[model samples]
Target: MERFYARERMGVQGSWSRHSAARVASAQALRGRDRLRAALSAMGFRLQ
Candidate 1:
């Protein structure tokens, strides 16, 4: 992990790490959006 950070700081390609990070972030965002939608729906809000 430290080696990865050092390479990243030095501007190495790091495509795999970047892609994995993006995927994780996207999944978390989707989960948060789903939770928010469910909360709103429970409050009687309708989504278009």
Candidate 2:
């Protein structure tokens, strides 16, 4: 019914927000890893 649709819309919006936040966090982590790799290379470091 109408109530079900209303609640479903809210749930979808909440889930979308959660997914967006996770994506942002993941991108930041990836950038951090890239920076770490660059730093390690600059310092002549490598992992076997």
Candidate 3:
């Protein structure tokens, strides 16, 4: 896990399977097309 943070622009991608999140818009944030995927999943929606 230590090596994962060794990159110059270190960041985390994907959802936290064991936790919930609430994201807000910000300039530093990327274009997350799958951001709502987790919420949809909790509501019983499946993705391809």
Candidate 4:
């Protein structure tokens, strides 16, 4: 259980770093709808 928690924490941190990197790279390249979709996907949500 402890190991699971630790791994989950690390995963969250890694994803946060990647998310920031992606945001910076995509900030200018994505348009409004695409930006919204990206934001939703980043938050682990999907648009239907």
> Highest TM-score: which candidate?
1
Q: Whose lDDT is greatest here?
A: 1
- Sorted by lDDT (best first), the order is 1, 4, 2, 3
**Cα lDDT tens digits for candidate 2, 1-48:** 445547777443445556556645765656576477778878999855
Segments of candidate 2 deviating more than 4 angstroms: 1-25
lDDT of residue 23 for candidate 2: 49
Candidate 1 deviation (Cα RMSD):
8.1
Clashing pairs in 1: none
TM-scores vs. true structure, each candidate: 0.34, 0.30, 0.29, 0.27
- Cα-based lDDT at residue 11, candidate 4: 49
User: Tens digit of lDDT per residue, candidate 3, span 1-48?
Assistant: 334444544554544431124343442342464467877888999977
State the lDDT of candidate 4 residue by residue for 6-45, as single tens digits: 7777443444556566656764744464567778889999
Where does candidate 1 stray beyond 4 Å?
1-33
Candidate 1 lDDT tens digits, 22-41: 64586564657647777998
- The reply for model 4, stretches above 4 Å from the true place, is 1-33
Worst 10 residues of 3 by lDDT: 16-25
Candidate 3 collision pairs: none
